[model samples]
Target: MARTSGDDMSAGATTPAARAEALIRRYFEACNAADRAGLIDCFTPDAVHYFPPGLPSAPWRSAEAIADGWVWCVKTLGSRWTIEKVLAGADGHEAVIEWTHWKTSVNEVLRGDEWYIFNDDITRIIEIRAYYASPVNKADRVNSLHGFDYAGRGYHLDPPTPDLD
Candidate 1:
């Protein structure tokens, strides 16, 4: 089963994976806030970060690696991360989380969703994979004051309404 995050602002239990996800969310927020230390807390010291070619390598193979790469991504993107969805589970010792990243750049919005897929059973992230696309024609655009302005940069969460689906 998959689930979307950003809900129960005041009446929900914070599971371990949930805390991890929250930390990940705050990591992005820290990037936006330009708080270097805060962003580094989201990853393991030996964490490995991968992105498409031509993009700089985000390797958190060590604490220093995390610091270096995390800073670079924050600076390079010139943007912050917005998690549109997050689903977490466990395998052996790993907690796996699948999620979507919404970002903006030069007034253009982009959407990227990933299934953190792999042998990440030591923590809570099972796998890591994603897909990104344009938001120019999305149905929500008409009333989206956020506009075509990078996806989720200035966006904040509204309490989750009853899930009708």
Candidate 2:
């Protein structure tokens, strides 16, 4: 069963993990409600949301853009989301969650996992990388987050050379 925003701890007063989880719950509530202001409050001003290839807007850069995109989804697609699980890092700077997005209007659901990078204070999300539960896109040479600077971000670009005797 998926969890709702009101199913868990309050956003204030708790461990880092609880706080992060609460914030995410609140963010999803805002998204389902199509509350633009509320959505914007959950992220840093320069926050970015990365999506897998094939999405019209691959990377939604900036908090405003992210909020706008979600609002659009809710309004157009009757979008609602549920958090299946959340795992916060011990350091509290990072967390990951599994989610299911329901497009009620179209009767479609998308399941995915999102890796979140929180700001130093752990108050707002600075980055989100979404990975969908779908088959690989064979058409794309490199199936990864579109428009993301993987190289600049120091992500592994190529596999290490194998050592064979």
Candidate 3:
């Protein structure tokens, strides 16, 4: 139950930058759909999706593991994760993204960011390091940028895939 949006593309044009943005959009869509295979396809075999310490799962894990982990997170944890923006790096091998997650149960919004490291082929992610701050006070909150109660708690959703289990 996640809703994702991507910036850096909206002109309805197929520029080189737009192609990169497409990858980000598709990754989020795969997560929302809980398509394990599609999610796996976004990463290399040894891909690492890293969360900060003190989270539910490892701060980092293999690509296959992340597939199941994300599904468990979005489905069981009731997080509606969205991609707010995507910025490709000048190096052309890395990027960082801003994400927002609505923690439905806690009724709060979580704001976070993740750094992406692509594989040698530049078609899949090899490493991802995510950072999230504690829930910012709604009193000082800006318009429509609300966050979740458990948002900044560094929750990790890593789990073993069925085949691996």
Candidate 4:
């Protein structure tokens, strides 16, 4: 459904964490409804959504792009998502959620966790890093987000060497 209210927050979503959770629920609702505008409203102008390797598009940058991608998935794949759980950080700037994506048309299900970074006020999501619970690709050396700039984003590229006496 299209977003009718400007405020994404529910009535009891007074705290930052609650607001963040509410926004995530709203985002999923938009996705299920194929509401492009509502999906766009959940993210900042330059928000980015990262995906594990294998998907045609690795990362969806910008709110418009992200919205379009999900809308397409719903249309073409008969996609629907269910939020299994959500844990918002105490500070409300970050959250992690477990979800199940059902590709109804293909009769497939994917379980994954997504790490979310919200804007300072917790009203909009700025970044999403998705990790899937799937078997590693034996041929691929690293099963990380395909197009993400790990080093530039300050992610560790190598495991720390062990200190042995």
Candidate 5:
């Protein structure tokens, strides 16, 4: 039996799952290089991205909405975004990715996962969401945009305590 375009992932120049992964890689590469246009190009015009920490109840519903919000975050937050792991679904429609956003000052590091749902043939990302966790710091005020705070008095900032609570 001959394989269809979706069936033989290796045969074609474009496969749904492969394209999604490639687009994802390019997105992060552009982020690392600070290419705003390239970053924006990865999404569909109607794509939605949600910063889970910032808005637990609401999500950025459009590319423009997300871009407007991303401006400030990118300006003050200096970091390299990289995918640590990726698992593409067998259906070639969705993927789960483990990624890291590491910053220099305060040596802040956020480890997270993203779930991507492609719009068509992985060429456009229709829905993307990320969830990450980092240590809490008192000086964290200047270091974070999320406004995280610790309650205890013995709190130390040198090496932030893990979020085991």
Candidate 6:
């Protein structure tokens, strides 16, 4: 079956959370489709986007700038996004999303989270703050970690408890 962004998601975006998620999904889908107009519609006229924690990014000031940013990312830099999780606030005016961005231009995968603050009517995003996560080098930090055993060679988080039925 041929997959499309709009068709991939479920129908009936009735709830505020669902609607917010739908808006975000639509934004990504528009980017995937290279729909410039669609991308601009996802944000408010005076939208703002920021990359926090030392990612040198110019704040996108308006909807046009946001659209241009994404267009440049996808077309010029060859970036793609795969959304992992979306946690909506109780009021449905805010959402935090975990996503993986494949930056083909730099041959890097950025695992990050973004906080989306919706407009008063929940129609579009007013602000987006992104945080990029990076793993610490084993040899860099010398400190006793307070957590589960990390002595044995090759230790990982416990796998899910098996449910043998």
TM-score of each: 0.52, 0.77, 0.69, 0.75, 0.65, 0.72
Give the TM-score comparing model 2 with the true structure, all chains together: 0.77
Candidate 5 regions exceeding 4 Å error are 1-13, 55-58, 68-71, 133-165
What residue runs in model 2 are displaced by over 4 Å at the alpha carbon?
1-6, 136-165
Show pairs that collide, candidate 6: none
Off by over 4 Å in 3: 1-17, 135-165
Ranking by lDDT: 4, 2, 6, 3, 5, 1
lDDT of each: 0.44, 0.74, 0.64, 0.76, 0.58, 0.67
Query: What's the C-alpha lDDT at position 160 in model 4?
Result: 23
**Clashing pairs in model 2, backbone N/Cα/C closer than 3 A:** none
Candidate 5 yields a Cα-based lDDT of 0.58
- Candidate 4 lDDT over 12-61, as tens digits, reads 77787887788888898888788999999999999999998877776999
TM-score between candidate 6 and the true structure: 0.72
Clashes of 4: 0
Winning model by TM-score: 2
Off by over 4 Å in 4: 1-9, 136-165
Report how far off residue 15 is in candidate 2 (Å).
1.4
Candidate 6 residue-wise lDDT, 1-165, digit = tens = 112122355546667777778777887677655577998898999999897544345787898988888888877756677565677776779988866665556555555678999987788989998776545223532222345243352322121121235
The order by descending TM-score is 2, 4, 6, 3, 5, 1
**Top model number, lDDT:** 4
lDDT by residue for model 5 over 54-101, one digit each (tens)? 554358777666555454445565555546566776555788786656
**11-40 in candidate 3: lDDT tens per residue?**
353544444456666677777767889999
Q: Which ten residues in a row have the lowest lDDT in candidate 6?
A: 154-163
